[model samples]
Target: MTAPITQLKTIEQQLLWLSHWMIHHANHVRPKVDDIKVGGHQASSASMVSIMTALYFSALRPEDRVAVKPHASPVFHAIQYLMGNQTRDRLEKFRGLGGAQSYPSRTKDTNDVDFSTGSVGLGVAITSFASLVQDYIAAKPWGETLPKGRMVALVGDAELDEGNVYETLQEGWKNDLRNCWWIIDYNRQSLDGVVREGLFERIEKIFDAFGWDVVRVKHGVLQRAAFAKPGGDKLRNWIDTCPNQQYSALTFMGGAVWRKRLMDDLGDQGDVTALLERHSDSELAALMENLGGNCVETMAEAFASIDHDRPTCFLAYTIKGVVTLTCRQSAKASR
Candidate 1:
């Protein structure tokens, strides 16, 4: 069997190339009268790439279903294109007449979409209903052959603000929901600015109250390993405590700023200091930004390790724009 790391890297590379090509084809290569920037969520896609990879390639069976986040439509299309579920012609005509729809369409798009998405929290909530449907079918005498696949939702953290999501939660709990996974891309930064602090805490508690398994995927394997070293606890604590805006600003500023900030915050601290000293600016930035949703290997491992049918929530942390340049530029320009 191929190593999970190698598979993850392959998934990452494929997603990176396909998503960028789709955007480039639409904006730069294709003819356009309106210079309004066909606006794809490159940053959002980047945040969910690894998570999707793990979910599709490793964690999910043929029966499992996913609802791609709205901004991640490009990445979803790109994945389908690679899997021969989409066409080059359609990709070339993205956001155009008869091209790929802005989001997955169970009825409209030609590709295979388990669920239609675009209305934000609606997509996230639908998975719970799907799970309920699965259970309802299983209870039927004719549904014995129905595959026992989990219904999954890839949610943007910003989507939590939508009241429909909370409504879905209540309904799900009332219905004794099971086997639904809501994997949230908690990048902290949103379309406007950083998300409100402590928002996720409230979310976690709510999920817990509803009997959902809340797996907080705050750090990747690399970051966890780093945190295990001497003084690493301090570094990890610092990262956990860092403000959302500061984290994003440093990402935009690149590695040098990351190093300077780390030193300033946790300098002269034994093992943490040595650890920072070992990595260059770029390396440090990569280390600091090693979020669980961006680590396909970690995500796959987590998914595969799940043995229960309980409603689970993977609060996966991520960067708003790790692999896409256009996404960042557009977000900045809008502000």
Candidate 2:
């Protein structure tokens, strides 16, 4: 990787560690006065780390604004902390009095925040409105010198179920929406269950019909690299066709299971089998887990590829939770 991409990747992991540690501390290490769970969404933040890194560190300018997903507040704060815009003190006191807010709170958080997000669907809807408002402002002579910006929202895939999302799409189409991006973290796993198969295809069509360009980011640099190898095509195909739930299960289960599952599915076909045999279990797992949104470089390249002023939607594949199941439990218990 080049220096810039390397830097972005480093920040991505840093944000991930700080965010997860913040949650862990609040939930597991902090002294509790009562039985209340000091909740933080560790998985949600994990799924968004690469997406946010590409956006804030690689793609966005001072003028561009983003409405971070509600569940990803730790990442939002951690990024702020890394940027020197936020303090370690607040991060250490996360969810405590005068510390970072559980959600991005404009009134509460000391660092810069364009839009306060919570209650799932509302922040997403607001991004579209913000775009419309941007247009409205730019149309005026007094506002003509204002720097134009993309109103971006980093959203969880499950959050798309909100009725207002479709309403916003329709309204944006009617208003000739431009300069807005809704980057959906399409991890496919929800608290209730896995997302319906082919939902991304449906979402793409829906966004296309509404005059917004949709970009689906499924495979990453690692998978794309593997695709260039002998018989990598079949491996790519299998990954593309895999079910959401199965993929999530395999991911959580780790590399040994992934190798076994891939080997069993693909059989002893020469090139394909050799491809799998070339890597250790850990290496295999790394390749398997490298979905586009989990990779900062992939996401950065994707964001850079867009040269248009049209409203865009990025369907970025991500792992819902990066921590182990036990850590997930700790996160909730803290909450």
Candidate 3:
């Protein structure tokens, strides 16, 4: 049996490399007539990679259906390519003639996409309605053969800004939504700026009110393990209390900056100083970056936690544009 974590890492690297390479090929390798940004949303794709990897490769069965986030088109296509459903030629010509579309489209692309998604919030809203439709169908005599599939949505945190999502939530509650999941890529950073503080707290309350089970995928296995360590509690507290913008800025600054920030903030409080002293900068960066939503293992575990198929939402924290050089540079340069 293949180790899930190892497999997750392999899928993560493959998706990251393939997606970014395709974007790079289009922008650089292909001749440009008008100097347009042959854009693939690198940062968005980066944030969703692990979650999708865990969902598609591990959690999902053939019957399960998912609506990919609008900006995470590259990762979805790359996953299809890896699964042998997509061709190399089309991947090379991405966002071009007969190539993979900017967003996964059932009619435009040859890949077996469950739903065609483009605009934000629409895909998410459709999932809840889809669940309603599924339930509707199953109640019929002709729908006996149709198996119940989990209707899932991979959504960006910013997409929650759309009014359609809330409308769907209220509708879901009214219809008794079940066998559906909305996994949010809570990267904190949006196109405009960092997300507001305690946004997820508000979301959690809203979901609870609407009768949806809210699972917060905050700290990954590493951080959770560390919480048991001597000074791990302090580090966890620091992470919890840190503002979204500050956390994102520190991450973009990289490992050395993370170390300095930790030292400055905690200042030898408990085992934090000893912990900082023990690991190298790179190690520290990784430890800090191992957010529960970013970790495929954690995502897989979260996905598994839902056994009864009640309507569920996973608030997954992710890093925006971690591996993509262009996206990282753009985001950093903006600041």
Per-candidate TM-score against the hidden true structure: 0.93, 0.94, 0.94
| lDDT (Cα) of model 3 | 0.84
* Residue 245, candidate 3: alpha-carbon lDDT: 83
Kindly list the per-residue Cα lDDT of model 3 for residues 193-301, writing each as its tens digit.
8898987899899999999998989987766766677888888999999898888778777779998998988896757877766666666677778787778778888
Each prediction's RMSD over C-alphas, in Å, is: 5.6, 6.0, 5.2
**Comparing candidate 1 with candidate 3, which one achieves the higher TM-score?**
3
Residue-level lDDT tens digits of model 1 in 174-199: 99998899999999878777899888
lDDT of 1 at 244: 83
Instruction: Please state the error at residue 111 of candidate 2 in Å.
Output: 1.3
The residue pairs in collision within model 3 are 220-292
Give per-residue lDDT, candidate 2, residue 113: 86
The Cα local distance difference test for each model comes to 0.81, 0.85, 0.84
> Which run of 10 residues does model 3 get worst, by summed lDDT?
325-334
